[model samples]
Target: MWKALRITTLLFVLLGVALSAWRNERNATDWIGPLVVAVYPINADGSELAERYLQALAVERFEPVSAFIAAQGMRWQLPRTVPVDFRLAPRVNALPPPLPRDGNVLSVINWSLRLRWWAWRHDTYAGHWKQVRLFLLYHDPARSPQLAHSTGLQKGLLGVVNLFASPDMNAQNNVVLAHELLHTVGATDKYDPSSGQPLHPDGYAEPAREPRYPQRYAEIMAGRVPVGPDEAEQAASLQQTVIGAKTAREIGWLR
Candidate 1:
């Protein structure tokens, strides 16, 4: 009887420790910042196109990315309460405010790129997520002047994408968006560049070469822009890596 009682006491103590640890972890994550997304105005035709793109993204499978994060045991959430807001142009500068000190702003379309430059010129951008993140959605790659060259602020090393580009173009855009987002957080591209870059570091490829880079095609940072079932696992892995890095940097995890 005494032996059984002692074993029960030990089990209870272990359970208590586990519960306490879990609570502490929960509290820690709760302290991380929120993600704020902003949209820039598109022309009537573009606006309609952008809306459809957003809807496509929302309805697309996110399982690959979500599962990847789950496997790594990380926590993340997209803003469910608000559909991202689009700001009308003209009066204000295309600038985003200072980093929330705890949060980040994700600008969609040209607005995002514009904001990134503002932050970069001012040296306000620490890096995406840590400083700010920009996500742009457009229909054409070769003809779009909106994607204009990047100033020193953004590396343009990686490109984040949207859904409106041509069927083939959209595929690359999806990969680009995910790849660029990861760059802000610290994931290097695994593809090669023509200039002897073994890996493109940014992970972009010509529309014709999409099939060759399996990692990008199968992974969230590359082909999973809309987040499909096959890519769900990759997305989760990406989330875990990016989220973990962001969280750590914010809380001095690196330090």
Candidate 2:
């Protein structure tokens, strides 16, 4: 009976995730108003660096994100600005375990379950925000700088960004944040995961540039500027990035 119950529970969880994904996708594509995205900070390591990171946190820190989206919207000729209100939430003591690295159905389901539980537990603090939410997990680079990674779920309305907690890293951090934000709204990664290089046309901000070897800007979704066929670098800030046409279409900025 216990085994049967466990199987049933798992099935229900999977079903819920599937339904939520579908609903969120539809809503994201059809969204017509300001999309409020609340950012919650998590001090992954209880160190002085994390404390300093927290001290530097302010709502204005995310203004660049808003400006970036607005600029993209105008470039796309949208009727209205892509309104994104980002508010900072109180820091959390802990974060859920990392998602399974394996790309299997079961692993995907497990990760989904964990993500959903985390969101549900933290939804209270959101207090009727009724839009996308992002959780930024900051870690001290001095302690374990080598262990930072960021991720977002397509149509999941939540993202987790792991980055060093320092002012110097703020620009790089926002670039990651913008990429992940687009993911929640149905944008896909345009980079090669294995090599971490932007893919062809789809990933290039100026795919038709005279000399494609050294593109000027990085596509927001692609997350890197291609300096050579096999080499790329992170955009210093959102100023150096753009929402490519493909990404704009994916995120419902264009039809």
Candidate 3:
């Protein structure tokens, strides 16, 4: 009888451990598929800003910026693995990238419309994604009139400031990077261009400046109320609702 009892207890312990592992793995898988940031070829010689911009893209892949945005009850369509690549070509079409075998491919193109269209044609075939979101930034600042008019041209397509000519690399990179990615899964920019007021109802004024609970940084998107570091901790607090199964489905993170 004692031996049988011992065997049963051991079996229970093993089962508990297996259950725990399954739960943890399932939770981790709830996020959107990995984010793949593909950089266009740098045409201008010695474009330091472009170089740094690509680095910033790499940084954003793993770094947690805003828990609320990350957890906004949208199952992030993050990939099982997020990959960012910087290609050295003169044009977007010339870069040889493997088309996404499955799922969405968020393409952030900073190149000519002709080249951008070419990429669009090749990237989107049948059975790619539930949707395909392609965004283009005006590659040239001198042509703002044409570019500005082109902002909302295509459906499922968005155009913003093409920062290739912006003197301030950091600001341009931060805004463009954050904005384009947000649009991929139906997120709207909180900041309005006219009054600079946050469009969303959230109280965050300046995410870069504020780091409050539920929010961090003054930038509103990921600010700490006290304005300090602890981004991972802040993001973790949001996970109860951020990376769950229901949230993932809402944001198309899971099919």
> What is the per-residue lDDT of model 2 for residues 111-174, given as tens digits with 9 covering 90 to 100?
8778868776865354665567788878887787675567777646878887779888888888
Task: For candidate 2, give the lDDT of residue 104.
Answer: 90
TM-score of each: 0.33, 0.87, 0.36
Compose the digit string of candidate 3's lDDT tens values, residues 1-255. 999999999999989967764553343334444433332332232345444444344323324323334433333445433322211212333332322333343432323344435556544223332222333332333433232211221223322324354433334333444444444433333444454443333324332333333433333232112222222221122222122233234335557
Winner by TM-score? 2
lDDT of 1 by residue, 23-49 (tens): 543433232443222222122224455
Q: Give the alpha-carbon lDDT of every model.
A: 0.35, 0.83, 0.36
Model 2 misplacement above 4 A: 1-24, 124-126
Tell me model 3's lDDT, rounded to 2 decimals: 0.36
Name the weakest run of 10 consecutive residues (lDDT summed) in model 3: 233-242
Candidate order by lDDT, decreasing, is 2, 3, 1
Please rank every candidate by TM-score, starting with the best.
Answer: 2, 3, 1
Q: Which TM-score value belongs to model 2? A: 0.87
**Whose lDDT is higher: candidate 1's or candidate 2's?**
2
